[model samples]
Target: MSGTWQCSPAELEVHLGFRESNPQSKHAEFLGPPFLTVCCLLPSFSRLDMDRFLMRNVTKGTTTVKRKKSLDNDDDVETAEDTETMQRSQKISKKNNFDDENEPQTERIETLCQTFSEILTTDLVWKKVIKSNLDLSHTILFSKGIANTVMELLEEEVVYFTGDLAKVQVFGRWHNIPRKQATYGDPGLTYKYSGKETPGRAWPPVVKAVRDLVNRVTGYHYNFVLINRYKDGQDKMGEHKDDERELHPDTPIASLSLGQTRDFYFRHQDTRPPKKLNIDKVQMPLHHGTLLLMNPPTNRYWYHALPPRATAKGVRVNLTFRKVVPAAASSSSNNKQ
Candidate 1:
């Protein structure tokens, strides 16, 4: 039982007396008082919905600090107050403050559990997930284009290796490819798009299809997409974002998954004891042939990753689409054949 877990105090109750109870009788009449008493003795355990209650009270303007640790002191209190003020100012003054292209994205991806028909039929402002902002027709066409393009890249021998995000292990095992301005999707794993500065053509159609899917769903055209292949449960990406210089400010990078279901987890950009989100329980099981679009403002507040699961095995491919403008193309290659 989780209560038996030794990691935290809250876990004690889960295992409390279970070992003895099992030996006594299979159907021993165990009333709730012991559990209730144990809960009462623990810190903050008496309240079943403590966090929710605290959050609700905060919103309702009832301010109280439920518990304080022995580590607290006058200096600590002053520092906490100062930190809170600074965070407030930063939130107000900053826009996409954590844009590290190498860092995993900071948007919490939501997996819609609604029935497929209900999702597709509902006339929400964002209907179906396609590449960022691309129309349905364009989405199809671009996918075809990307497939052809990647094939060509392979044929031309431009790519040294073509694999999934998990296979490369560029980022740490527990993290996803980060793509914020600071780091930009774990550079070690992200395909070397412009690193060598080759005058290669735009990403081939397979890549484009991936890109188009993201653009249509997220409503932005990413200039580039670094494709990574993860074959089986062993492969993984670390936490990072796509805040690269090439990425337009506020552009949402879209990811399209193919070939396997993987858990995609997300957490807030910063953490305060009460502010942490329930990310571990809320991860999306990214299914094969699914499109996930992170909202543009997502980076400013959250960070996401593809954590490894022991149960997962087999290959999964993800195409993260972005828009990159070529300096040479913009200046002189406008009409060149």
Candidate 2:
């Protein structure tokens, strides 16, 4: 239960004890009689939902006013007016207005939920839960305006590392890698990519926003995001299993795609009987503004990649958000690569 909440007086309160609390003021103003009639009346909504709602409604006060022994003015109290201001501001802002990215992303998404909260849980446009070797879900995340916004952010804010592909020791000898890539994550999140140590860079704001959205839809806390920029049909990826030593095996990997749609290929790592022939090799078209979540053993047995489409002319951006353990930490725990 929300601690010590006061109800504001209104006809609705009498009908339902839930009060019309002010958003701007410090506390809800209670004036009318106690609410008797109700359709499941409560001081506030769900604690989890309210936690996010409050962040969306409240803003940093301009001045640090100490708890005065006496009231400075009734205006010092928070009220519906403040909440109205927050609502209007939130509706107008579709971009990353919140500068602090380190705070919990669920709180950020919860803020967005306040705008039209009833539909927050229904955000995944076409979510399909798979009960197979992998804990996977293929869901479309954005459409129309929101999709456009994501594209713009990807184009303007996210910077790709454009340089000669580093010659990594593949089968022993060094070989240049294809596709431009960038990695963002917490400090010291290093992984072996093509026999090269790839240390993660600090997380970006927009990237963090995308990660938050994925977490909201998939319920996974992804700490590292590896972005692959396919400039055109020429840039491609090789089929490889993500069974690496650093990755947390059970932690599912979430991939968010933007820009061009591409055919992503997948196949089994080991030979299976005819009953599993359908999954021996499969091609799934990953469309723009969609989320593909690959869960456990999938990484352990399935190898996936985006082959050179040749026909695809448009650029495609894909972010594989994952959780990686620190090298020292991974050394101790026998986690599946």
Candidate that would win on lDDT: 2
Off by over 4 Å in 1: 1-202, 209-219, 272-282, 325-337
TM-score of each: 0.40, 0.59
* lDDT tens per residue, model 1, 1-337: 0000112222221122111211332222221111100111111111221211111112222223232323233232323433443343344223222212232222200101111111211112222322222211111111111222233332332242322421222123332222111112212222222111223245543344434445544557566555556656655554434444444555555665655567664445443135454432224555444455565655445444565555677666666555544453233333333
Among all windows of 10 consecutive residues in model 1, the one with the lowest summed lDDT is 34-43
Model 1 scores a TM of 0.40
Please, what is the whole-model Cα lDDT of each candidate in the order they appear? 0.35, 0.52
Q: Which tens-of-lDDT digit does each residue in 206-300 have in candidate 2? A: 67777776777677778788888888876777555676657777787888888887876555644332334454354567766667878787777
> 305 in model 1: Cα distance from truth in Å?
0.9
**lDDT score, candidate 2, position 257:** 84
